[model samples]
Target: WFISYALDEYFYFGIFYGMILVFSFYNLIMFIAIRQKQYLYYVLYNLSVGFFEMSTDGIAYQYLWPNAPEWNQVAYAFALCATSIFALLFTRELLFVKAKAPRLNQLIIGVIVIRLIFFIYCYLFNQTLFSFKFIEAIPLSVAFFTGIYIYKNGYQPARFFVLGYSFLFAGFTLKFLIMLGISWLNFGVVSYYSLSFCFVLEMVFLSFAIGDKVRLLKLKKDKAQQKIIKQMAINAKLKDTVNQELETKVEERTREVYHKSLIIESKNQALEEANSLLQKQAEEISRMNVLLEQDNEELQTSVEKVSRDRVMNTEVDFEEFSKIYPDKESCYGFLAELKWSKGYHCRKCNNDHYFSGHILHSRRCSKCGYEESVTTYTIFHNTRIPINKAFYMIFLIYSSKGKISSHKLSELLSIRQSTCWTFGSRIKKVMDERKKTLKKTGKNGWS
Candidate 1:
C-alpha cells in the first residue's frame, strides 16, 4: 500500500509539475510578448508554488537535488516565501486591488511583509509551521476579502478570481486536513492527485476570467461607439433641418426685397418718362423758334422753279438713294415711317385707330373700313410704273440743272416717251399743289 501510494505521489508530482511548468512558461512568454507585469508575476508565482508542492511531496529529494539533502529541508520555505510575494503582486495587478480595495491592498502588503519576516526567522530556527499558519490566516484572508470587495463593487472578472482562488484555498485546506490525519476525506491513494487537479482547475478558471474580461470590455466599447454614431446622425439631421429653415427664411426675405426693388424701379421709370417728355417739349419749342427764323430767310431766297421742285438734290444722290432704298421692302418701310410720323390716322374716316389690311402693308380705318396704302397721296400715288423707276424719274427731273424734256428723260429713265410725259405731268401737278399748300400755310416751300 505504501509502495503504490509513493509511486502515485511521484507520478502525480511529475504530471502536476509538468502542467505548472507549461502554465508558467506560457505566462512568461506572454509577459515577454505583451510586456505586462501581471503575466510575469503570475509566471513566477506558478513556478514557486509548483516548487513548494514538489518539495512537500519529496520529489525534489528524489530527483532535483538528491546530492543536497539540506536543500530539500530549506527548499519548501524558500519556495513558500517566493510564491507568497509573487502571488500577492500578481493578484494586486490582476484585480487592481490598490484602487478598488485600498484597505485590502494594504492588508496584502502587510501579509507579504509578515511572511518575509517569518521566512527569515524560520530559516534561522529551522522551523516552517509559523510561516504556513501565517499564509493561511493573513495572505489568503486578504486575497479572499479583496476578491469579495471587488466582486461586490461590480468588477466583472472578480467573480472568476473568487472562484479560482476558492479552489486553491480548498486544496490547501484539504492537504492541511490530511496532514492532521483526516482519514475519510483523504480518499486514500486518490488524495495524491487531488491537489494537482485543483491547481489545474484554478489556472483554467483564471484564464477564463481574463478572456471574459476582454469580451465584456469589447462589448462595452462597441455599445459606446454605436451610441456615438446614433447621436451624430441625430445631430446631422438637426443641422440639416436648421439649414433648410434658414434657407427658406433667406429665400422669403430675398423675394420681399426683390418686390420692393421692383416697386422702386417702376417709380424710377415713371420719373424718367416724365423727364423725357419735358425735355422733348423743351427741344420742340426751341426747334419751332429756329424754324420760324429760318422761314423768313428761305422766303427771301425762294424762286418759283426751286419752290416747285419735288426732290432736293442736296438731300440725297442716286448713290445714297440706292443705299437707303435697296429693295421694295426698304422703300415701303421708309414711306410708312414718313406717312405715320405723327402716328397712324385714317384720311377717309379721319380716325386715329386702324387695323392692318389683307393686302401687303396696307391699313384700314377701324371706323370706316377704308383701306390706305403707304404710298397713298404721295408722289408715287396711282403709279403705272415700278415705284423705283418713278422715284428715279422724279429725282432726275428735279435734280437736273436745266429742264429735262420727255424724250430725253424717257431715254435716261428707260421708259416710253408718253409714259415719261404723263409721269412728269403728274409730278408737276403734285408739286403745284404742294406749293399752293405751303403758300396757304404762309411758309417757304424751299430752303
Candidate 2:
C-alpha cells in the first residue's frame, strides 16, 4: 500500500509541476511579446500557486530550503497571499473592472489588502493557522463575483472569464467541504488534486477571453477605416459630376457665342481679311506637310496664328491664352501698344512727345512733364487682380459681344466672380459708350 501511494504522489507532482511550468512559461512568453500587464500578473499567479502546492506537499523541504526547517511552516502563507493578490490583479486587467464596474474594482483591491494583512498576522503570531489554506475562499469568491458582475453588463469577454473562475470556485468549495469532515466525498488522489485540474481549465478559458477581446477591437478599427474610404469615394464622384455638368454648359455657351461672332465678322472688312488669311495659311501648312514634313517657318506661322487667335477669341480657356501673355510685363506691352495706337496725348497735358516713365510701359510728356501709365485711363486701372487675368477678361468680354455673364468670365479667367462682375461692368459701360464707333471701326474696333 505504501509503495503504490508513493508512486501515485510522485506521478501527481510530476503532472502538476509540468502543468504549472507549461502555463507559466507560455504566459511569460505572451507577456514578453505583447507587453500586456495581465499576462505578467497571470504568470505570477501561477508561480504562487505552484509554490503553495510545493510547500504543502513537502517538495520545498526536500528540494529547497532543506537546511531551514523552521521557516517552512509560514512560507505557504506568503505564497497564498501572493496568489490572492496577483489573481485579483489579473482579473482586473483581463475583465477591465475599473472601467466597467468601478465598485467591483474597489472591492477586489480591498480583498487583496485584507488577505495580505491576514497573511502577515498568521506569520507573526499563529504559524499553525497557515496550514488552513481553505481561508483563501474569500478572495477567490470576490474575484469570481467580479467576473460575473462585469459579464452581466454587456462585456463579452467576461463570459469566458466567469466560466473559468466557476470551475476554480467549485474546486475550492469542494475542498472546504472535505476539510469540514465529509469523509465519503474523498476519492483518494483525484479529490486531492482537484485544484490542479481546475487550473488547466481556467488557463484555457482565459486565453479564449483574451482572443475574443482582440477580435472585437480589430472589427471596430476596420469599420472606422471603411467609413473613411467610403466618404472619400463619394466626394470624388460628386466632384467629377460637377465638372462634367460645367463642361457641358460651357460647350453650349461657346456655340451660341460663335454664331454671334460670325454675324459681327460678316459686317467687318478686317475680320474677313484675318479669317481668310487664317484659312489660307492653315492650308499652306497642311500642303508643306505633304513633302518631308520637317520642322519649318510655315508650320511655325500656323501655330503662331492659332495662338494669336486664342488671344482674341472668347472660346479660349485661360491656360491657352496664358501662353501668349504669360506675365505682367507681356500684358503691359500689349496695353502700351493699344493705348498709344493713335498717339500718346497725356491726360494732364495733351503733349504728344514723350520719354519713358518710372513705371514699366508708362510714357512722360516732354513739354508739360505729365506722365501717364499704360493703365492710366484704361478699365484695368487700380484693379486688385493680376494684370494678365484682367487682360484676358477684356478679350473674353469683347469677343462675346458683351453678352457673356460675369460667372462665365470668372470661370474662364480664374478670377473671383465679384471682381469679374465689377471689371466686366466697366468694360460693358465703355462698349455701350462706343457702340456707334465700334460699328464703323471693323475688327480693330476694340483697340
The TM-score measured for candidate 2 stands at 0.55
Worst 10 residues of 1 by lDDT: 302-311
- How far out, in Å, is residue 447 in model 2? 35
Who wins the TM-score comparison? 2
The deviation in Å at residue 134 for candidate 1 is: 6.3
Model 2, 1-447: lDDT tens digits are: 999989988987898888888888988998998789988998998899899888888999899999987888777788888988999999999888899889988998888888888888888888888887887888888889888888889889889989998988888877888999999878877788787778778877877887787788789778766765676587688667766765675567557556655644453544357676667654544454443233334445655554555345556778867766767877898889998999778677777799999788999889988888888878888989899888788778887778889998888777889989998899888887788676776634543
TM-score of each: 0.54, 0.55
RMSD of 1: 42.8
The prediction achieving the highest lDDT against the true structure is 2
lDDT (Cα, tens digit) per residue for candidate 1, span 263-296: 5456556656778666765565456556655654
**TM-score of the candidate numbered 1?**
0.54
Give each model's whole-structure lDDT. 0.74, 0.80
Q: How many clashes does each candidate structure show, in the order listed?
A: 0, 0
